[model samples]
Target: MSRKLSPSRVTSPASASVEPSTPRATRTGRRVLAGVVTSGVCLCLATVPASAADVPPVVSRGVTIPAFYTPPAELPAANGALVRTEPMSLGLAIPGLDGRPMPGTATRLMYRSTDSAGQPVAVTGTYIEPSAAWTKSGPRPLVAVASGTMGQGDQCAPSLALEHPLTLTGDTVSVGYEALAVYRILATGAAVVLTDYVGLGATDRLHTYANRLDQGHALLDAARAARKVPGASVTAASPTGLYGYSQGGGAAASAAELQPGYAPDVPVVGTYAGAPPADLTSTMKGIDGSALAGALAWSVSGFAQADPDLRAVVEANINDTGKAALKDASTMCVGDALLGYGFTKSSKWTVSGKSVAEVIAADPAAQQALDKQRIGNLTPAGPVRVATGVHDDIVPHAQARQLAVDWCRKGANVTYEPVILPNLGDKILTNHLVPLITDQGNAIDWLSDRLSGKPAVSDCWSMPLQP
Candidate 1:
């Protein structure tokens, strides 16, 4: 989800392209790549609506954010309760085609969702009502998209990306890469809801990156809030599907596992989790010296936000370097992290000269906090597709594969796809990112089938036999 990009690569809003190389390309792979590239290019040309100028601006971590992102002092008692909403502008538009924007109408919204501690927190997201017609069986279905590793800054919020897909301000760099998936789903005549997770958009707190409960609840509640959007075509009867990769894959997987109990009212039909960080401990180790090493700071900062004991552990164990890195990372987006902290060692930030993972292994409280973040303990309720890059070392492939294996053991309907590609490189992010593009077509098609009321045949029986 985090791409290493230079400012020249994204000169203007329209210049961004979804053009990643597919290693073992197939006809379908070529088609999927072309489709996403076309979709991204078209959307990049989108102009902000006139109304966007009238909305007041709010600032977060020195970056001016939209006023719509500011939450009220108090929240509703119920989870998934709508707080506020406003008309949003999608950057892309087709001029000659009825004057309406291509893809759909966008709405920026804030809703109530429970935190890891069961406290009601306001969450922000964007809901897109597709202009295309649903050719499938049911009423226009809803797909709740959880974005992958957008960074910890409020300015990095995915909802903000709808208006400006790519931003380069001072040292911060933010890209709405998730838009490709959103646009693809919309092209199928399905409504899309993209959650900003807990604090990514809201000004009240720092983003709790990779927190399972917070992210899962935010995604499920987004579906509930989307239904309440006054003009949205989606209703309670709309079948819901979850989609995400990397960090988002973890959220989608968490949502599927939590849906049965957290938001039973939301009917989640299927889930597409690509390279989910199922085991946070293992994931932390994988990302430590990798290109996206800043993510380790995000995890530490996020865990500290939710757990007081873990916070205490961090405060006592972390040195001045660790504190500054976490502080810097808090205000940074993916691109900023990639530029400033890529391939940096986590051991440099600690007092004991041990990596964050090593420190966590030594401390019981920190280990317990991270243990709560693991995703495969519970069975996901619906048919779920788990895809992982065979060569991915950033989030790591083995942990992702284990998530499917764990779910299969629980008897949950599951489809496991191992994207076998040559190792693009080590610690550079190519191996981690390519499969997200290569396998996306099959992932979308699988979810489409579930939304069409087709029964999913679980490959759990064969999982044990394959690697």
Candidate 2:
């Protein structure tokens, strides 16, 4: 009750207005609205409370959630096995976003996937079949959407966020901004599957936030699970694409790289990664003293979950303030984090009297752990479109450009689009977030073309971005 919530547009080419994270407040002083909606009935349902009796029942040795989230003890040895599925509806309503109910059928799946340790783990996500028809060329495509930074809490899962728009942790609520992107993909008449990631909503373990292997495994498996969903009418041979921004973008990128070796059965045609934090080490340094500083805490906690060596390092150096901040971040969604720790320097939390980035750089084990989370090291099996705002400070425009350079060097075809925006000094929200909104439509359109068997024409040669 006290804390439980977590929470893009492309602007016009002609004009770059003030960049707002959400919608801009009207003259009447109402909160800015997220511009995504269509006509439909609201079939919203109540979520079961998070009480002891209401906790999801355990069906396996390590799996548990609500009854809807239970996994089978006799799990399939193969990855992407559909353990259980139930039909549900998607209602779109966010405080800042203008959205309507997108009536669709939801299928809950329990599939085998690898965790951070490369061990088999059962992960759950939902596959949705929208009522729309596939008017596009080729068979109806399937999109696996990796949500942006939702939070580290189970209540912050995108699956739960879609069902209950009011889900929030602390003061920040899950506004379902990613829901807008999901609905946008749904509008294309393609069936969409949204992954809850490994531990965020699947089990009681801490979600390995931004862990490349775990995020990639969950994403690829979601596409595999979609095929087994009854009545989705999507087959194993269906053209599949990946859509995600920010954290989701990193997952999509990792999935693209891991597909050739990990899950060769799922034919992924294309992937769109917007503002992906492909290089975690640089990203940590870039965001240390910024509005999204809480993300640094999340990243540290994530590495700790996967690497014992890194965990030992963190425990040894992190002071009491840092420890408390990490604990609070474990249960917060991005919304809560934004309001709670915006613009606070990482130095305040550490005992070394240095920033988190400096602390990590000073230690070899910690640096190695952070380096392992970097994406773009391997070549993607399919065409990829990477979008980054030129003035974006949160993810760093230079690192994103460098991702294109790295991918092209490995012979992977890439379409790099640096969103041009007016320089807004000290306006962190607009510079970082505007490109996410402005380039979204273009990213989706590009992926749609690839999903329909259209060849991607990329400017693969690396060029310097204008300052």
Q: Which number leads on lDDT?
A: 1
Cα lDDT tens digits for candidate 1, 399-438 = 9999999999999999999999999999899999999999
Q: Model 1 reaches what TM-score against the true structure?
A: 0.87
Top-TM-score structure, candidate number = 1
How far is 284's C-alpha from truth in model 1 (Å)?
A: 0.4
lDDT digits (tens) for residues 1-467 of candidate 2: 11011011122221113233322111000100111011111111111124323332432211123555433334566888876777655556222222433445666666777787766666777788876678878888999999888886555678877776665332345556777788888778888999989766754345678898999999999999898888778998899999988889889999999999998898999999888888988888777777778888777776665676666666667777877677667656777778877787888887888887888888887888778788878989789998888877888888888887788889887998889888665425567777878898999999988888999976775455433
Instruction: Point out where model 2 deviates above 4 Å.
Output: 1-65, 70-74, 93-103, 168-172, 425-427, 462-467
Task: Give one clash count per candidate, in the order shown.
Answer: 2, 19
If scored against the real structure, what TM-score would every candidate get?
0.87, 0.82
Q: Which residue ranges in model 1 land beyond 4 Å of their true spot?
A: 1-62
